[model samples]
Target: MVTIQLITVKVTAEPSDAVTEGDTVTLTCSVSDVTESMRLVWINSDGKTVVEKTLKEEKQEQGLLQLIIQNADRDRRNWTCVLFHQNIPKVLIPYYLKINMRARILPDIWIITVSSYLFVKLGFAVGLICCLKRMDRISNNRNPPKATGNKETVQLQTLNSDADLRSSNK
Candidate 1:
């Protein structure tokens, strides 16, 4: 009877941030449940082998996968991290790396759309408040003055007689 154990490998990137042009990114390939030593094979998108390292006589217990990308080689590409046992096929996990130069800008149409929506909502609220205040003032009218029927005419006659007496004395 033959017993073959399959090892699981996971790929993880440091910082886990969005990469732009002229930037460097490092990816680590880790293997789990290792009874014996293993090997790592890294391949780029152009079907080219980038790295191959053996951890049989290394001082570190865990395998170290180090990738150094220069400033000019930070463009859009795909990278694959593979772990292979001695006699079995390798297990592969692929990652797509994208690099862009410019940040996505908000469209002018979207800004106009949001601004118009806010204006309509705020205008309606202010108009409703003003109308309610005016209605409240009219409803609370309490002081009603009497109408001027003949009081003005009597006051004017008294004023004329006083003026004539003053002129005669002078």
Candidate 2:
């Protein structure tokens, strides 16, 4: 008769599950049970092994593997923690990372804020111009323009015209 022992492998992210872009992220893999032939490996989304460790190297009863990523990005979002016993894969734990990029959203808000401010200023200038025009119109209606004339100059012109007409008739 033979009995089998179960092992639990877990992966966790340091700082938080979600991080902002350009932040440093750390992924830790821990196993509940450690054996002499047990190996822990960290794999990327592309099925490439990043780091590997064995219980002999750690000299501990529990297995732990850590991978650090500087400047987290979309390319480093997915990872896998694989535990192997005697060169055979036993457990696989996958972790997904969330990165927030504020650069994509802030510009839209800034453009809208600037546009609204300019619109308000333009509206105020237009209203001021309209009010000034209205006031000028009211003032003009109250005081009409007066015509300017020289009385002597008008009389002389009329006399000359009359003389010229009489001479032509004679």
Candidate 3:
């Protein structure tokens, strides 16, 4: 009587599932058992084989394979680990890589934003000054200054008051 053993395949990412830009990531594919006819394969999201390893008859223990990615970016996000027996797929494991990108502000764009803000403020100030000037003109036109007699007549009235004060003192 022959008994068949069930095989299990698993894929794991080293460091963590989330990483920053330009980081290195390692993917490990482990099988519960290794056989002479078993093959381990790593493929990308596009179904392209990245790496493959075939178990030799000499090693009958568990199978382990690793794929290293250097400078990981958003483009290298999806991957799959597959196990094959006699060129037929037996197991498949999928992995997704999350990359955190830093926000960047361009120098030219920053300058333009600041310039636009200052320009708007200046325009508002100029408009306010012009409005105030116009209101002042309108107010002056509505209420003209009261005229206090002519200069020469005011001087003559002051002289007469001085002469009357001297006579009253006498």
The prediction achieving the highest lDDT against the true structure is 3
Which residue pairs in candidate 3 collide?
none
Residue range 49-92, candidate 1, lDDT tens digits: 79877767344356767665655244435888877778454688
Tens digits of lDDT, candidate 3, 28-130: 9998867566889999988999999988656787888999999988888899999888999988989998888845658778999999999999999999999
What candidate 2 gets wrong by more than 4 Å, as runs, is 1-4, 57-60, 104-170
Error of 1 at 70 (Å): 1.9
Q: Candidate 3 — what's its lDDT?
A: 0.87
Q: Model 3 misses residue 74 by how many Å? A: 1.3
Residue-level error in angstroms, candidate 2, position 130? 29
lDDT of candidate 2 over 1-88, digit per residue (tens): 8988776788889987689889999999998756456889999999999999986634547788999999999888999999888899
Better of 1 and 3 by TM-score: 3
lDDT score, candidate 1, position 128: 99
Worst 10 residues of 3 by lDDT: 99-108
| Rank ordering of all candidates by TM-score, starting from the highest | 3, 2, 1
